[model samples]
Target: MNTLYFAYPGELETPTGGYGYDRKIIAGLEDLGWQVELVPLGAGFPFPAAETLSQAQTVLEGLPAGAQLVVDGLAFGVMPEAASLACGRLDLVALVHHPLCRETGLSEDEASGLFESERNALGHARHVIVTSHATATQVADLFGVAEERITIVLPGTEKQDFAARGSSGKLKLLSVGTVVRRKGYDLLFAALDGLRECDWHLDIVGGLDADPGCHAALLQQLSGLGLTDRVTFKGAVAPQDLSGFYRQADVFVLASRYEGYGMAYTEALAHGLPVIGSGGGAVADTLPDGAAIYCGTEDTGKLRSALKLLMTNESKRLDMSAAARRAAEALPDWRDAAAQFAVALGGVRR
Candidate 1:
């Protein structure tokens, strides 16, 4: 049957890449004639209240017999009891953006607990869909999911004309992602501080509420580093506004400490913006060679040098911009991503 229920936490319209991925995939599936029902499990996922967990569990346990259920890892990881019960009566698929334990700012105990919970929950999945090859490896090695049971379906990119530099005198550097510790904005700030002599204005496009302490620290860091005037935190923006930001950008930079598969990086490539970023997580793997200049994740000096190279060398930036456009051509579109997802779903065993 071409029918499935997609269960996830939070509102579907959240401006994060993960949510955006879900939205596009669901829409693509619908275009392909799949009967997909979205199940909003709850907003406080992965750490929902006791009652919320109970309610989610009840909902899962009561789904029609022999139904196809695909649960997002954020909510599924912490609900092993529901997963264990649901798998017996349904073909349960686990859609993991990344393993929960790898998130930054978690205590060792919390990390360990999440690891155990995710591992337990994943054990019940008839099949697993991950966003990148690196994440599939992590699921197999760290979470004990068999490699044969996992499928890597990457995020698709929209077609965009090449990004053009704005009329502003300073180079426009763009960064996209939530203002959280995992994104390495602290390291990015330090790196940019060393390049203060360069003419650049950074526009950070992301939500500031995901990690309040991290956002507050970043604001304080910006002030202490004397970058308050050079940086603008535009906050989460609508898709149209974000596209405008991309069009006006000279270079796209992000120093994410880890990522399942960086949808933002691919977006920048699609826009044909020269890229500067770290080799953390799957980012290096995501970009084709020459599409970006990468540095060590925690090396402020190296990141600064990479940024300066792109900022000061228009010739090199042009070459990378061309490469970015070339790389984007090889990336999957939404229709391809949806087809890959459907194939992955076909492998699920009840």
Candidate 2:
């Protein structure tokens, strides 16, 4: 049986989309009879301390010669030297959810450093797997990797019953993602604040602990706008409970600054919730026409107008809900994604 060593940062069970993709892919690979090993590197990655780098190096070195090693981009981007050391013996595959440099709230210098480092690290890989076509193009263009060397394995959505729209008169908007700067919860708050007269309530379901500072700032902004009563911060829900949030919500909104693959948006569509989000990164590819209302990340006026229309116009909302369901039914399940992943890996052996 073939063995695959997967290395990633933090706990594998983290609630973020990138980690979720890793976990699901791992499970899928195992189901296909691959002997997969999961290696968790310590936190503070892609910007690790000296000790973290040393530890990662040790982990990579310890793998058997000629082992098939897959490194998540979050850690691999900044570990060019370590990856280069392993590339001589191991078949290195870089699994990039997205480029680390595109993360929000980074200085130009920081972004440039990450971009250059990632470009170098990816050069050592035998193959690169990205979660979206948008990210594949990004790697080819920005990192100068050839397009044929990259594989696009889009994220899969679980098949679920359509969300039962709440008839509570008020529009229940749901936003799901970590409460970090990248997810753009602050922008979502600002957009919703301007539509106070639209009779809407927002439920943000994500981890606040990922970035306590961003969480605090969002809370302050909500208080300042007196929307404390209108919004509820339901930090990270249980898997079962998350489905409930999706089922009860009338619409889904996430104004993310960038996404390699916005799993939350796909999950929302799986539950037949109309989405409202920025047209950045891979979102345009993930969501279909008539299913989403797209705007620029900073276009609060456009988002507000979209929200207001969805809130008051029942006919339009229903049309979007139908479109969302259609899109959901067309999405590939995890099994199909895994098969594609297997094919991608097969090419590396050739």
> lDDT of all the models against the reference?
0.88, 0.88
What local lDDT score does residue 255 receive in model 1, on the 0 to 100 scale? 89
Which portions of model 1 show Cα errors greater than 4 Å? 163-168
lDDT of 2 by residue, 1-350 (tens): 87889999987888778888988889999999998998887898878899988998898999989888899999999999988898999989999999999999999999999999999999999999999989999999999999889999998899997654635787888999999898887777888887867788899999889889999998899999999999999998666678888888998999888888899999998888889988478987887899988877667888888888888888788888888989999998898888899889888973
Which runs of model 2 end up more than 4 angstroms from their true locations?
Answer: 163-166
For model 1, where is the 10-residue window of minimal lDDT? 161-170
lDDT of 1 by residue, 3-60 (tens): 9899989888888988899989999998889999888888787789999999889889
Worst 10 residues of 2 by lDDT: 161-170
Clashing pairs in 2: none
Q: Count the backbone clashes (under 3 Å) in each candidate.
A: 0, 0
> Which TM-score value belongs to model 1?
0.97
How many Å off is the CA of 331 in candidate 2? Answer: 0.9
